[model samples]
Every structure is written in structure tokens, then in C-alpha cells.
Target: MEMIIHLIFVFCYPANNRQKLLPKSPLGGCHSMKILAQVLSAALLLLLSTELLAGPLSEYRSPVAVVLAKDGHWLATANQTSGSVSLVDVASGQVTDELACGTHPSFLQKCLDGQHLVVTDTFGGKVRILEINDGKLLPKATIEVGFEPTGLAVSPDGQTAYVGLVATGEIAQLDLAAGKLVRKLEVGAWPRYLALSPDGSRLAVGCSGESRIAIVDVPTWEVAYTEKLSGGINIGHMQCSADGKYVYFPWMIYRSNPISRDNIRRGWVLGSRIGRVRLDDSEYREAITLDVPGTAVADPLGITMSGDEKRLIVAASGTHELLVYRRADLPWEGIGGPGDLIDPKLMRDPDLFGRIELGGRPMGIAMADDNRTVYVANYLKDNIQVVDIESREIVREIPLGPSISANQIRQGEAVFYDARHSLDQWYSCHSCHYNGGVNSKAMDTWNDGSALTMKTVLPLDNLSKTGPWTWHGWQVDLNDAMHKSFTTTMQGRRASEEEKEAILAYLNTDRFPPNPFRAKDGSLSAAAQRGKRVFESSDANCASCHSGDYFTDGKIHDVGLGADEDQYEGFNTPALVGIYRKVRFLHDARARNLEEVLTDFHSPEEVSGTRALTEEEISDLVSYLKSL
Candidate 1:
């Protein structure tokens, strides 16, 4: 602050007055003084901008969710990394105000009243309701939902709100007027997105982890139907049709296969897609392979339709582009089997689909009333990109300030999320290790000698510490592991040495929030304490391989879980730090959940060659593991 004040004075002072502060040497001419003033002016402006962008919004702004004002005078963005919400004036393209939010602020929803703005603080597990008045936002109320509160949907009358709780697998219904939770409706795993129909009669919930969509009848507040998706993963933004006839969403598909270049090109290993389900009858369904033959789409995170209902827009975060599809030209059909899936080559039809390369990660989309103007939240760039739909070009970028210097960590983050470096812009490392964590699917990275042996995507939390890397315990070097991830897993060009270094620096910064499963003071519960005894006891023998402070011995163990075709004789011991967040368990993902692992496939006798855990013991052990 002192330095800033000093610089400001030097820059603001008249040249003659500043001469007193400069040296009396002959070099201190009027011309030199004028040049110094110009340099000081630029430096001061930059310093002020960077400093003001603080409060956790400096290097990585991460604007994942954005919303538009009803009158089209202003817009707002929910930044995840910065944990703040920014309101920008439409005409000026400058942030009017910024409010500090929570641990991770995600999806945003606006009410018909245009005064109430709802934001889900994802990791903080709270729904923040703010009132828009006098061109600024003021905290109106807060509703404590549950852990990992993500996507949000509000009623047409602005009286009610539905919040998706990712961890607990439930949708919290909040009475906005009362500022409290009314009740919670149980949904499938990872209910991270919610879409309210235009008529406000139905709520569509995207249960990404379970590969299904749950429809809730708003009048009765009950799940009317659950639509199962074909190989769906990372189901992101969903939008109901103007007539509420169908709900469309963008997601990725993964088929368990060898990580081969041919398979990737053929869209057999992993692919991007857009799915539609008929809400009018609750019987029909449609999905499209968004990936074309030569160029593939990745990480489609945001979706919105034009007011005229003529155009559909999707923001592909990984690919860093906007995918535009004419509503009339979409190859919509029911997905009944592998053959029923839409042909990827069909996307090649003229005027069927279009692309606008948005440089940074495009995470959220908001269409204006004019139908042709759209605002997109560019996560990596810390700005909102305005694009003209008719022109299919970026109109302008309204910066949200804090121009961070190019550091190695920031440089690596760009590489980590950049899909352009991948094969034809299909996917990045983050497509699997999502948000520096893990994706839901089991993928074959081909690190092991076996081709078809699949392994669950490991969490990058505390990655640098837990090594002897892959599931097969080969590739001890972290840099080599990263290199292989690109060349082998993504089938992309070999990553440069500098790229690997920056990525490692960024990966080391990945962290998990406080475990909601644990007590407030972070101590184990009574059940967990009892389970701790079982875990450490020789009878269960869990700590034999899963030992040490990081909860892994960093050694290979037989574990009795390897498949017959696996060339590797043993598997590396995985750490148990954040197992609560994992839905898929075991190296092959045979156990859908941790409970299934403890009771069915990975019983004490099955993994550790010890006595089987009784029912009470299993419950206690689950409690203990969740606390970690």
C-alpha cells in the first residue's frame, strides 16, 4: 500500500514538482523526467488494477458461472477460483461491483422478479441470495443447504429455489421468501446441474455420475421420471426448450477400451455429446455425438438457446469454442443402443453446426433478449466474451480486471485446461482429472503394459507426495507421467519439458475443501473412532499397504484385485485421503461405491487376506474412511 501511494504521487505530480524528487545529476533533464512520468503512469495503473483484483481473484479468476440482467443493462459472473461474484455494466464493459462469496461459487440463477440473484457456493454448501438494487448487489439472505451445493434453479414467481447438492446426491428446495430450506428430494449421484422448465411445472436434474437425468414434478415436488443416458459422463449445463417439450444438455461419453490413437480418432475411447430428453411425454430421448470425424469437441460446460428458439448455443470449455447448432438441423433421435447413437459424420452437413473459437475456457453462457447477442464467461481469461450470433464472431471482451503476470504456475494451468494441444481439440488432461480432482469414469491411460486394463481416474490432490505413479506402480517420475498422459492417454503430441514443469507447479496447488463428513472440529466420530481400531488392527490389516501420514505406503501390493489380462502383477497402493468424494471404487471400477467395495468386492478377506468384517464392523469402517 505504501509503495502504491508513493507511485501514485510520483505519477500524479507535475513534472517540475517531481524534479525535486529526482537526482540532481545532469541526466535528469526535462525530457528524461517526462519519460519517467510515462513509465510511472503505466506502472501505477497496472499495480492498482492487480491490487484491486485481489480478495482471491488475482491469478486464477475461474469465472465458471455467468448471468445476464433482465433489462440488458448489466451482467454478473460467479467466479469459482476467486470465490466472488462480479457485476459488469453492459455498455461500459467494466465491473461495477464485486462481492466476495465462498469457498467455491458455481452456478447462478436469476428470478423473474429480476431483483433476486441466487448463487450456489459449491464447496461451502450454501445458497446465497442477493438483491440487485441501485446497480449493485447486497446480501439478501443465505440458505444452508448441504455439502457441495452446485447448480441452481428458481421458480417463475421467484418464491422457490432448487439447489443441487453434489456430494449428498439430493436437490434442496428452498423457500426464497422465507429464506430457508423447505425439504430435500433425493436424486442420483452427482446431481450437479438443475434446469426448471419454462412453465415452471418440472425440474430437470442432471445426475452426471449415475449417467441419468431425474425429472421432478414441481407441483408435487417428486421425481416424475428418471431417464438413463448411454455412457454419459461430465453432464454439464442443461436448458429446457422454450415450450418445455425437452431438456437439452452437453456431456461427454467414455467407452472402456484401450487408449489407442485409432480408438480416440474413432470416438471409441472418449467423446463429447449433447443429449435431449422429452419432458412433454417423459418417454422420448435424443443424443448427438458432438465430436466430428477429424475435429472433436471437449468439455461442453454451458448451454443456452436463443429467445426466438431458432438457435442453440453451447460453450465447450475444454475446446475453448462456442458450438452453434441450428435448432431445425439437429440430428435428434432416441438413443436405444450403440447403433442408435447419432453418426459423428452427420455434424459435417452444411450449416448444421458451427464453431466460434473462444480463446479461454468458456464455462457459462447467457443469451440476451435480442437473440443475436450472447455473453459468455471465459474462465481462464477473467473476462466476459460478447459474441454476435448472426455474425458468428466475437464482438468484444469485457475484462473483469486483475491482469496477472505470466508466471509458471499460471502458464501450466493454461496447458492443463487447453484442449487445443490435444488431438484435434478433443480433450485435455482435465477432461479426466476434472478441476484438478478426478472424473467419474474408469479410463485406460495405457501406462501399464496391458491394453484393455482400465483404471479409475486418480485425484490430483497431494499428487506430488503420492508417487510411484500409475496403477501398475510404473513411471516413478512425475514429469514422465505427465508426458505420457498427453502422448498416450490423450493421443496428443509430446508435451514440452517446460509445459510439464508448469503443469506440475499448478497440480501441486490443487486442494480439497474441508471434509463435510468429518466433525466441525475435524475429529473422528464415535463410529469412526471404533472403525479406526479395525483399520489399524492386524485382523483387518488395512494399514499394511495404506499406511503413513499421506495414507499410502507408496508401494506395490497384490491386493487380489488385478484382472487376468493385466500384465502388471501388482497394483500401486492408492491413498485414502479424499475417498469420500469418489463414487467409483477399485482399479477397474467394479465397485460402484465405497460401500460396495467394503461389503461386496473388496471385503477384508478379499483384499487383505484377513477375517471378513461383520455388518457392524463394516458400518464403522465406512464411517472412519469417510471422515478422512
Candidate 2:
């Protein structure tokens, strides 16, 4: 059962609405010792009663993207888990249509004509075009693109479209009329968000895995400049300003290299921030912290500017609130250089004009033409929350469909995304393991009270198959790993035995996605075939360590990368499955790319038993490894 608090906020609302305060919860705020004592007592009683402990698990829809129709009469949202696009009537606040898009729809964009919609079928690896007439969506065509397409952007003339091939690290330009790919341009790792400038001269692409943004010259169809966003990871959502002067994006900012898990409580680890960068010179202009004096905002995802350009709204996913900031209240001129610390003191005293409560885990947000009404796709609620920006109140919660019963796996998934398990609702497991993958940040967990070695984030897929979890092989059992993670990483209490079991169950459900390198017949390429022979040959000696169906022998090897400061004996042999999606490699993330990992000292002869391989052999080997 998820802990849900539905309260009417009046902190920045009208004076007349201030009297409608809801009863405070026992475990509501951080400083209430009396409330914490009462909550603990209540929790003890609940645990004692079997009926109270075994409550029903709630189902979450996991909506990803939302957009307003060109005509502004209806709202469309892409429901990722449901594999459908929901349309709601703006005036009535009722779901008028639910159209089957495809498997795991990630993003939606209404065409300029207002009669057509383009949706990216992320897992299905296809772009679906649907025609909308009077609120009903009719399937038009489905164009197969590269693997795991997520972000979508239509050309200014509406004759072409560009999609971010997340797994392939490229952008596919599609001809709308022919319904085929015109060309594919290599960008960087995991291009998750694409935003075309207002003038359609530049396309701003946020490469989530690389922590960088590439500005593509639209006319040349080539990258003009790349901007490295310092101290930020998972740069997913981005919005270009009205004048195309800058791009505003919400990203989780790492204050410093996390030396210990204790840094979380001290507020020196992860913080939510809104970043602004100039497009002309490609400079990382500024990063403004979203935290106030006492409250720390976390997981700022969806960001948008109001129609009047006076207000900046950001959806704080971990906090479950919409942080509204007045443009005039922001200290734009006083912002420091790129190296300056993102101190909360540089911002306005109150920081936000209002913190309006929203539905569970809001991800994507879209404002109406008037900008007064905001449509938020609530990931955990399976609904769209219509919010009145002026009054800072939820106008309506438009349910997408009837809720269904969730099983143990779903329960575990809810727990994985629930921030309540973390102290002060700082973050959840999903924050670091975004989309069951890495956030592309090196963190020092201080697991053994040592901070010298920073560990790179790993993927969560095929968890049951890979044992001896963590880079250092700290915990062989998944249960112990979960317990230690909660107590140390999250700075929270240990979960119940049942909760741990449920989390493991959910983790076991994850399976590796299809390898895009394979042909239609599921056969490897010529290069991969050659590479497979080399991988299993005596010269490589890879099979001795990386074997079995899961690609690991369940062992740890020194291979001579461990430094003196490392507390552990050796590094765990990580699986090669889905290796193409990795942005960084090795335990300490010393090798930034696969090529570097293979060419580093003590890597070829020590890890693979030979260093005299030819360049072609190395290329083929990399190709085969990526195919896994």
C-alpha cells in the first residue's frame, strides 16, 4: 500500500482559502518530534495486526509525456505502462478517448494542423502517426525507426520529423510524406529529449547519458555545437525559451562528488535545479537551485514557461508538487559563473511563488494556450491533473481508466518509485536507476567507510541472474543488498522482510530488451560472428570469467585495477548484456568509453589474456559485445 496525502495547499493561495487546512499527519514534516513519536506508535500497532499490515496494493499507470492540442480544445497524454494515449476534454475535464498507441508510448506531439498526432512507441521501436478528428484518434501509419525511440520533434514546415533513438545514440530524420527514414545522424549516448528552436534554425538535443546537449544545425543536419552541463545528470526534459535565446531544463544537480552516504542528510549530494544555457555561444549560462530555506526540492522533471513568459513552472516529482516561480523574482543578473556553487542563498528568499500539491509522481507537463491551465501526467495515479495556475489548486483529476488490482511485482515497482522510503523524501530507487538503467553518475556510497573509489551506476535489468551485487561485490544476497541500500544509501530504516521479498520479485521481472544489432532473423552480423569466435577463443580468455546464459561466471577478479584506497578485494564481473547502453565503464568509471576500457593498461592482457589483437579484431569484438 502506498502512502498518499491529498491536501489542499493555501500557502500562496487566496486568504479566504487559508482556513481550509487539512489535519496534519503524524509523520508529515521533518521537525515534529511529537508527530514522529505518534506515527511510530501507530506503525507498531498496525504491524501487530495482520489485517492492517496486509493492505491492498494500488496500481500506477506510469504516464510519461503530455501535450496540448493545437486547437487547445483537448489534452493528450502518453501513458507508458498502459501503451495508450488518453485524450481529455478541457472544458468537461473528462476522458473523451483512449487510443491504443503501441507498446510503451513515451512521447506525444500534436501536429501543427491540429488533426494529426505523432507518438513514439519506445519499446516497440516505432513511430506511430494517428489522425484525430473531433477528439477521436485514428491510426494512420507506423514507421519503424531505430531501437527505443523516445523524444520527438516535427520540422517547422511539418514535412519532416526527428526522433531520438535512445539505444542507438542517434537522431533519425523521417520524411513525413513517404513515411520513411531520410537519414540518421549520430549524436551522443541516450538522446532522450529534443527541442527545436522557435525559429526552427537549431535543434537542441539533451543526451541524458552523456550529461551534454548538442545543438544541431537544422539546415545542415549536423551538430553545430555541444554544451557540457556540469554537475547535472539525466537531462531529460528541456524547453526552449520563447525567443530561442536559451533552453531551460530541469536536471538533478550533484553538489559535489558524494564522498559518503552521510552527505545526503547534510544536503551535499543531489539537489533539484533549473538550468539555463545560451544557445548562441553554447555556454552553460546558469544553474539555479530549487531548494528553499528548510524544504529541499528533488527530481525536478517537467519544465515549461507560461504564455506570458512571466512564470516558470517545474514539476517536482519526488515532492509531488508544482513549484511555480515568478520570472521577475528570479535573480538572473546576479547568477554566477559555471564553476560557482548553486547556493540557495542566491535565489529569492521564498524561491517559489507557490508549491501546489499535485497527483502522484508528475512527469510531463503541458500548458494551455492561455497558460493559466496546466495539464500534468501523473505517473503513479494513472490520470491527468488539471491545475489552475493562478489559484494554485487542482482543478480536476481526470482518470484515464478504471484502476486494476496490482500483484506483488507491481507492488514492488510502486515501492521502487516511492520516495517515502528515503529520509525526508529525498529520492527513490528509480531516481538513480532511471528507467531501470543508470543515471550516469559516479557515486561514493561509503559502504566500507572509504571514499577514495567512486562507483559507476549500473543497470537493474537481469538482476536475479547477476549475483554478488555492486561493483565491489559487497553483498552476495539480494536481500542483504536491499537492506544495506535502504539503511546506508537512503539513510532510512530497514524494510520489512515481506517488502524486501516484493522488491526482489519486481527486480526479477526485468528482462533484457532485444538487441537492435541483430537481423530480422535474430542472427548476428558478420562482424559480430567473427567477434563471437574471438570472445570464446583461447587468446581472449573471456569465457573463463564471462560465461553462462547471463554472461557472467558469478566471480570477482582483480585484473589489477583496484587501487590501494579500495576496501574490497576485487571487482565483480559485470554482465555484458545491454552493454551498448552504458555511458561509462569499469568500477571506478576511469574508462569513459568502451574503446578506452579495452585499450587501458592491464585490460587486454590481464583481463582478456592477450594484448596483441588487431584493430579489426577489436572493432568486431566491440560489435559483438554490443549485440548482447
Candidate 3:
């Protein structure tokens, strides 16, 4: 029967045409029936082959965040890649419920009321509230928010919600009772997390792209201060001390500006560290270094302190470990000095308590009242690792759902996000191109085979279409480009041919997100419509270079913006589909904003031709460019 089934599937769905039978998730509607068929087929296949079952047992469906239920009897996980939330019984280590949520639920938080859970659907651009009853989750309501809602924080009173609009670079305040948007407050670039103080008077927004935290006064809804974290690139989960005296979070630390992969081998460039900021004074300091001299600790995602304030736990996503530090052992004083840069020896390190091997990337962490019990969302493994904090051991591994079957694209994604491929398990491709997006940093990659030359990191959206990769357009083949990246930028050994092929398959899956500038009716605005004319017109001549649907001629050209340290004369024209989310512009990150890209950097002849339009026309053109 198994042989006959295999023969039928292989003949009917043939390996070469198998992709057609598979569902195209991004295209949605038309592929629903096909998707269902594919799911059934996958289920049947899983049952037939016991060897293939291991994949579903230990792979990630992109678990984003984890939160414990009110009574501490259940754990809820926002599985982004799975587009659902898993509710697990704490005592039994069994998934009691798998509640379907909106598309790509990235953030999950338990409301102050204890009976409610707030989930942020990033791609769906909505916030979903679910009711918890007898350890099961039921959809309560959903409110549409801004584009790419990445963070969620319910007000202390549970009457209001502050959501971070990642693509729009603003925070939308939602009135839960009215089920309407109260207002929008502008903050830093790409705010990933919104952490409210214990007293609820202040809000700290972690701006990952800009490397700063914007502190907002809750009553006024205005940003009163901004704390700049030195030596950090991206900041993650944050929590305020119980007394509201300090805010603790994890951030990636770079040894110097314009980081190079060369430093990875020398053990100087990349590291992870916990940062502490005084709430009252806005004083920021690097509290403890997670990585040592030769080995890197990798991406530190979630962070939280124990109830007794004795232990500091960090979820090291890249390294797949839970890093614990004793509060008493940390050198609180004389930090940010020469003595702080030294690496701590794991066995003899005074501050280092223990490193618990999670065997999968951990995303979010929550501790119980006892402080000894901790719940961790093992992102890649699709399980909640119940950690005994005092013993520094994983006591239980609760399976959330059936393991997701891995394909070439999924395997490629695993390679992309896996830090083990890098030297000393430092960083992964995901660290720079976050979720196949931009990191908003300029780095001396030496991709053109020259030193001391810097280029702004570009977005990987629709990367396969924009090839001849790199600023200088050196490597035309996608596979070769990926292989070179692994060896040079990651400073790791060359990957096998199979691994290279998987990476290429993963790159082909990337697509641009929906533009937020469009009207609710899915029509272009008046400004954007006018700008579209300017873009395609002879006056602008923008269509000559940026011609195709992916928006690039696939050729290098010199618009006369080369710097002294540039390795190449002309840079590759980048795709502008998701340009609105970019924090910096130009090949070298010389322009800070979109306006400066056109005004100071872009040549007049390249943009306006002979016709110099009015300010309105320029504004319209800018609007249209962002809409693409």
C-alpha cells in the first residue's frame, strides 16, 4: 500500500511539477482548495514514513513570543510562521488547544485582566484579543491597527493599548472599549517592543533600527526623552523593574562602527549584552556581556528577571541556549570601562551562573511567582521548554503541535537563521537581514575584495529578481553569492553544495510587503497618483533605470555619488518596493532619510530631467516612491 501510494503521488504530482500542486500562501484565495489538498497529502505522507517524522518533531514554525496564563496553569505561544497560538497545560506538558489567529501573529501578551490575551498579527495588520476559559483560547475580538503591528502593550488599567507600527514608524493607541484608534504618536525607526514601566507613567519603545529607546510619558503621549544605547545595533524584549527604577533588555553589541566579518575571527566585532537604563535619569549602561572572547553568545531575544531579583535570564535565540546570570555576581559598578570588555570564562566566571542548552532557538521567556520555574518559547523546536531556574535544567519539553514538515525553502531558512554555521556561533544571516528585511546598518563587507570600504546593508526582499548581487554587482549567480556570504561575511567554513542550493531556494521565497501608503479602498492617494505620473514621465526618466515590476534594471550605473572609501565606481540599483521601512539611504548610508536621498544625493538630471517641478510635485514623487 505504501509503495502504491508513493508511486501514485510521484507520478501524478511529479517532482519537477510538485511546486505547482503545493499551495501559494502569499497569493491566498485561489489556492485554498489546493492548500487543503496539500495539507492532506502531507499528513498522509507523514504517517507512511517514520524517518520523515523527525522533522515535525524538532523544527520551528517561527514561534515569536510566549506568555504564561493568569493562573500559571497554561502557556500561550504566538507561532508566527504557523499563524496560530498554542495553549499548553503547564503540568501535563500537553498542548490543550491550538487556536487559529490572524496571519503571522508575532507578538503575544497576557492582559492585566488575566482572562484576556492580546496577539499582534503582523502581516494581517490587526490586533486580536482572545478569551481564556478553562485553559482553552477562544477568539474574543480583533481590531485593525497600522501596517506591520510588531509590538503590543496593554495599559495598566487595560483600557488602552499601544502598538508599534514597524513599517509606519509610529505607535497607534487603541481604545479597547470603543474598539477604535485613539491616536498615533511618532517614535523612532522600526520600534520592535513597547515596554511600560511598573507605575505605568512611562513607556520605553525599543527602536531596533536606530539603536535608541524612546521614552514616552503616558499621560501626555509625547516622547519626553530618548536614551541612546552605545555599542548596540538591535535591541529586543525589555522589562521594567518591579519598583520602576530600571529597564532591562538585551541588545547586540558591535565592537566598532562599520563592522566587518574579519573581526569575527579575531574575536572583537560582535557580541551580545544586557543593557540597563535608569527610568528617572535616562542613564543607560551595558550591564553584563553574554558572550566571551573567542565564542559569541548569538542573538539574545527575550529577557526577564526572577521574582526575587536574584537571577537574570536571557533567551539566546541564535545559540539555542538560555543564559543565566546571578545578580550578586555582576559587577554593577565601574562598567563601560576597560575592565568590562574582558571575556568571562564559563567555568570560573563569577557572574555566569549556568548555560542551559535549549537545543532550539528561544524567543520569549516568562517566569512564575516562585522564580524557580520558567517558561521559554523554543522558536525552532516548536515547543515550550519548562526550565528549572535554580537547577539550570530543562525539566520539561511540552510539544505544542505536530512538527511542521521541512521543505527546501524551510531548510534554507533554517540555514539562514542558524548561527552554528558562523564561527563560534556568533550571528546568522537573520541578524543582518532580519526576517529577510533590512538591518539599517552600514558595514565594511569587503565583498568587492577591498578593505576599508563601507556599503549600506540592503533589504533582501525580492532578492532573486534584483541580482548581480552586492553594491558593485560582482556575483551574478545567486548560489555563488550566498556561498561567498557564508565564507566571507560569516567568517565560517564553506558550505556543502546542498546547503548552497537550499539557501538559494530560501532567497527566492522573499516578497515585498503591502504598501501602507495606499488608501483603505486599495486605491492610490492623489499625491501618489500624481507621483506615479512623474515616475513614468519623460521629465523624471525614473522608469529608464527602475524599469521592471521588481523595480531595477539589473545593471550598475554611476550617478556620481561614490565616496573616497568606496571600492566600486557605480553601485547596483536597489529595488524600491519596500523603501519606506529603510532607515538610511545611499550606498554608504550618507543620507539619513528618504527626503535627503532625492534632495542631496540624487542628481537633478536623474530625477527631474529638464523640468524643475514645484515643491508639491517633489512631495508627490516622494509619496509615490514610498508607495511602491
Please, what is the whole-model Cα lDDT of each candidate in the order they appear? 0.81, 0.73, 0.74
Q: Estimate each model's TM-score.
A: 0.88, 0.86, 0.87
Q: On a 0 to 100 scale, what is the lDDT of residue 296 in model 1?
A: 79
Candidate 2 per-residue lDDT, tens place, 1-628, comes to 1111111111222445323322454565433434434654665466447332232321244677888876678888887765677777877877766665666788988764656788998867889887777766666778999588988888767667889998878998887767778889999988988888888888888887788888898889899888876656767578888888888888776655553445665556766667776766666457666664335666778888888888888898877889887765564421343322334544434444678888478889998878788889888777888898888889888877677666777767767876668766666777788867777777776565576467878788899779878887767778888887787777767988978888878877633446777775679999999999978877766678889887887787888888888887887888888888888788777787776776664356767667656788778888888888
Instruction: Name the candidate that leads on lDDT.
Output: 1
How well is each residue in 1-628 modelled by candidate 1, as lDDT tens digits? Answer: 3233344444444555566544354665676576666767776677668654333334466788888888898898998876777888899887766665666788887863777688997777788888777766667787888678989888878888898988778999898888899999888888999899988899999998888999998889788998987667889988998889899999888887787777777778778888888775677567777776677788898999998888899999988899888887776667453332336545556456788988888989999999888899998888899999778899999888667765787788889888877777778888888778777778877878777777888888899999988887886989888877888777789889899898888788744677877765788889999999988998778888889977899898886777788887888889999888888998988998777897778777787677888888888988899888
Error (Å) of candidate 2 at residue 386 is: 0.6
Q: Specify the poorest-scoring 10-residue window by lDDT in model 1.
A: 1-10
lDDT of 1 at 355: 87
Two-way lDDT contest, 2 vs 3, winner? 3
Query: Least lDDT summed over 10 consecutive residues: which range in candidate 3?
Result: 1-10
Give the runs in model 2 whose Cα sits over 4 Å from its true position: 1-60, 259-262, 333-352
lDDT of 3: 0.74
State the local distance difference test value for candidate 1.
0.81
Report the Cα lDDT for residue 203, model 1: 94
